[model samples]
Target chain A: MIKRNIFRRTILISLFIILFSASTFIGILDIKLIDLLKLDREAWHNFLYFRIPRSVSIVLASAGLAVAGIIMQAISQNKFISPTTSGTISATQLGMLVALLLFPMGSSFVKFGFAFISALIFSIFLMVILNKIKIKNIIYLPLIGMMYGSIISSITSVLAGMFGKLQTVQSWNVGSFTLLVKGRYELLYIIFIPVLLAYIYATKFSIVGMGEDFSKNLGINYKSVILLGLVLVSIISSLTYIIVGPLPFLGLIIPNIITLIYGDNLKKSMIDIIFLSAIYILICDILARTIRYPYEIPISFVAGVFGSLIFIIILFGRVKYGSK
Target chain B: MAQNKKLQTGIISLAIIVIICYMLIKLIGVRSLFALKMIVKVRFPKLLALTVSGVLVTSASLVFQSIVNNRILTPSMLGFDAIYIAIQTIIIFLLGSVNFLLNPIYNFILSTGLMIIVTLIMYRLVLQKSKNNVVILLLIGLILTTFLNNMVTFLQSIMSPDEYLNLSAGISISLTNMNLDLVLIALPIMITCIVLFYCDAKRLEIISLGEDNAINLGLSYNKEVIKHLIYIAISMAIATALVGPLSFLGLIVVNLTREIFKTNNYKILIIFSGLLAIIFLLLGITILEIVGHITTLPVIINLIGGIYLFYIVIKENKI
Candidate 1:
């Protein structure tokens, strides 16, 4: 078992490296390692300014959300709940709009604070609603979440439209790394803290997953852990959303795929989740750039196409009924 | 015999008339015969479009909800709106704005056709596999919608700013500045659908009662599911294709109709849904126009309707 795990990790990490380099180098501007070695200004500028930040953002955002998904599933006790399906991204978008409207020209921290707060509030709201509903079918969880997200997005659109910032909000909502520059994409790193927090509280989250009564009997603070798990989810959700907009289904798909292989051992499978998410999003980002050549489609589009297709297949394979 | 029902009906009609009059009052300047002809040719079609499409969509949604035996689920979950917007995107992407703009007839055919086809494909995929699990079906449709929505936005991003702007304007449900030709073309089909739906009102009400009720009443519930779903899909596609996508309006209207009319009779409920739809949409459009039409009609309606959906869900016994 140990050897098999090692072998799997080796293959996944190797795959990640290859895809990472490929995503980093393949773009509109042609640059080679030789130019960076020779202190080439233009090559270095493009690499540092656009290509590297974008590629890094891709990796960071994917890794962050993938772990966030695991955290969400554990705390919510439903495999279907993720940032993509839940209202977190939509709430983040709305909060960003609020920040934009309020500050107009505020610092990124203010926007980040706003995004995090709204996502946290949204998490609390959804949990309250979820607690009230006795769901037999797991699909109902994501169903309610998706409707909530759409409603939140509708509110966001109305506000953005009222402010005459509809186009800008629309652009932000479309998850893409094309506009990533040095300063713009750096805020994505903050999501990494939530990821670390996920790792620390992994066991508690899985225990929380069992249900409120079980967790409390096990001498855990049921509510606080749930709050903590959701907070971690909200943080990663809002930060990555503010940075890369939204990577559609990245969170949901990665954890699901990871679970199939590694089971629900969050502590053990965290690295694997990161590896898979990084590689998956790297492939998406590369395709988004290369598919239309000079004019890049958003990574969310590529991810959505691939993710939903994969999700349907996975859904059909496992979910025969709502009986479970 | 209830005064409340009478009062509600009177109130809705009054709101509809007041809003319509307010909208038309602005167009009061038409002294010349040529100007009168212009009003008849141009403004008349838009007024007709809003009223007809509103009624069309609300009825379609009512039938859909009744078929599924769920109050909160709108026909939008059938992936109608997303497919409509997606087809519009593909048209703009392929042949530029001219195909969608100068030739409204082609988009009308292509858009509605694609919408129906997508719905059929979804039906085949989910219904056949799951033996008609509505929740699973809703989930699949929701997934498809988000995917298509993402695809449309991505395409719009690739488009030039001007073209993208035009596409956004065209896709968003707008009350003002509609195509007269498309509205005229859609009017006959929408009316036909509404009439056809009304004919099946009694059967639908039986279905809405519950599966056992439907079965006891000699309705082969499972077999009839596909037929009604197809009808719902086609008419919804037609309605959404006509007036962009008023996704939440249907949910809001149908529920309100049931609440106000307090009738299990699909006939009365369907007619009330139509009138309430016109009242809500006309007032919504009036609000949009009053507020400088800064945003689209669907956005505001969706905002209100979404909240109302949560209200229904929360107020219901945990289903």
Candidate 2:
């Protein structure tokens, strides 16, 4: 146990260092706010004000998404699953497309609200369908999710094509942290705080992970807990997508790494998730900004590509141990 | 007797599906003699390419799954998709969008042939040892995927916005732009594989029972498996080249085929699986066209696949 804790601490320290170095690189390479905007003192002050809100937005969005991912994986009992991978992102895209087409004059908040609700509905419908299927093997799970997600994505693509909005849709779907200015960032915070509290309602989620009969014996309300978890996950995921677009693999990679390192304890994973997700986003931000000097890389691809490697490594290790 | 019935059903289903597809395409203003001529000239050829490509992919996936004794694996686990995507990103970055289809047929054949040769060599080396560990293979694939993704990112970063737009726009699935020559080449390769599969139908069933069982049955399991892998590489190359990677499409189709067909016969299963893929792909495209048309076909496919995936997740009660 001592050895394990020491190893984990080492990992955390290294992660922090990498994140710090990347940020330092960004700071050194990127033009400062004053130089970037080349504005007077008043404008500079306004920029600083917005900067704080954007930082707040990043923190809230990452934490909320991380927690939602944890709750989702725990309840669903599948590490390979995430909102991004499970069609939530597609649903959000669909919602956003509709909002763009139907409510050109609507407020961002109203648009975000609609997106969140629709994504939640879609996710729940998916979960219900999943529950109905009598699975013969576990492999069927991801396969089915992949298929379902593909179908939704196909729909989104077809719709985008017809509306002549494919280009816009693609741009919107490619996640980035560069656009989180003042007004947009506040909306994320408003959504984040309440959802954080609602996560407590899903304490039974980990219990549900213990199996239905086991949970029933413990007098747990499995259905309601699952429902609450789904709602929380969907809301947070949709809002994040609306704010920063859909991040690939962050939702899967963070929680799974947290669980692998911190043990399967949900609360502990939650804590790790908060810090790790922020660090992840920040590092991705650095890579996005600095990779090409002036041009920014989309953060989604960074997380997906890198995070999936980490996931595969862990999976490989598991297989090795199992085979042994 | 059962084999005869199965063969008859297979022929009937294939014919019906093709006719329906033809009718549907016709109904969508391909009705006039001139339009029919146009479809034959333009659409039919492309559609034929897609069909053959689909057959190769499904059959390859089925054989791969059987040999590995795992139902849920795709050749993408070999990192070929990553390599394909990486090559694409780099080529686009270098060439910009200026007649991007410059000798697509040549490029497709060359890259696919190169991939096949290299993978076959690696597969041989791995198979020479203990068979490829599913997880280990996946890890290698993952690592390669990461490396390629990073390279693509680097390329995208350096690329101008116009270049990036051209690259990414063409990156995802769009079957309208396909290479006829590559499809023609894939046709013969697929036919050879199907004939080979037919020749070894019994052996494949025995192999699916497991390595030990197959060995007990005096089958040269490794050789047969390697043959299948080569076939898979060819098929996957063709399909991926034509349509990019549609991961769950084949997985869903093959499983649906097994579920509905309720048979373990490889010969029957192959035809059923191929027909099912065509029907589903056309159906999906039709749905996308008829629906709000506000989204992409892939997004819709992902949504349907995801919901099904989630259902499988909850029901199985495993991570």
Best by lDDT: 1
What is candidate 1's lDDT per residue for B1-319, written digit by digit as tens?
A: 6785676669677866765574565456656776667567765776788777888888888888887677877888867888888888888998887656777677778888888888899898898887787767888888889898888877777788878877887788744557777787888887888788889887888888878889999999987778888888887887888788988888998898788767788888777778778778777766665667777888888889989988887887464
Q: What does DockQ give for each predicted structure?
A: 0.58, 0.29
Interface RMSD of each: 1.7, 6.0
- The runs of at least 3 residues in candidate 2 whose Cα sits more than 4 Å from the true structure, single-residue gaps closed, are A1-47, A132-140, A198-203, B2-10, B13-40, B68-86, B114-131, B135-180, B220-227, B243-262, B271-319
lDDT (0 to 1) per candidate? 0.83, 0.67
Worst 10 residues of 1 chain B by lDDT: B18-27
Candidate 2 per-residue C-alpha lDDT over B193-244 given as tens digits, one digit per residue, 9 for 90 to 100: 8788777778789978988899899988767777777777777766766666
Model 2: how far is A9 from its true place, Å?
8.1
Would you give me the overall lDDT of model 2? 0.67
Interface RMSD of 2: 6.0
lDDT of 2 by residue, A1-324 (tens): 868766766686678656654453353233364554576665555445544455566567777777877777777777666776567777777888889888888887777877777788888887887666565444345445544555665677666677777667756756666777566667787665645565555457778888678889999988888888887877888888888876666777788777877766675456567778878877777777778767767777777677766766665555555531
Q: TM-score of candidate 2's chain B against its reference?
A: 0.85
- Worst ten in a row by lDDT for model 2 chain B: B126-135
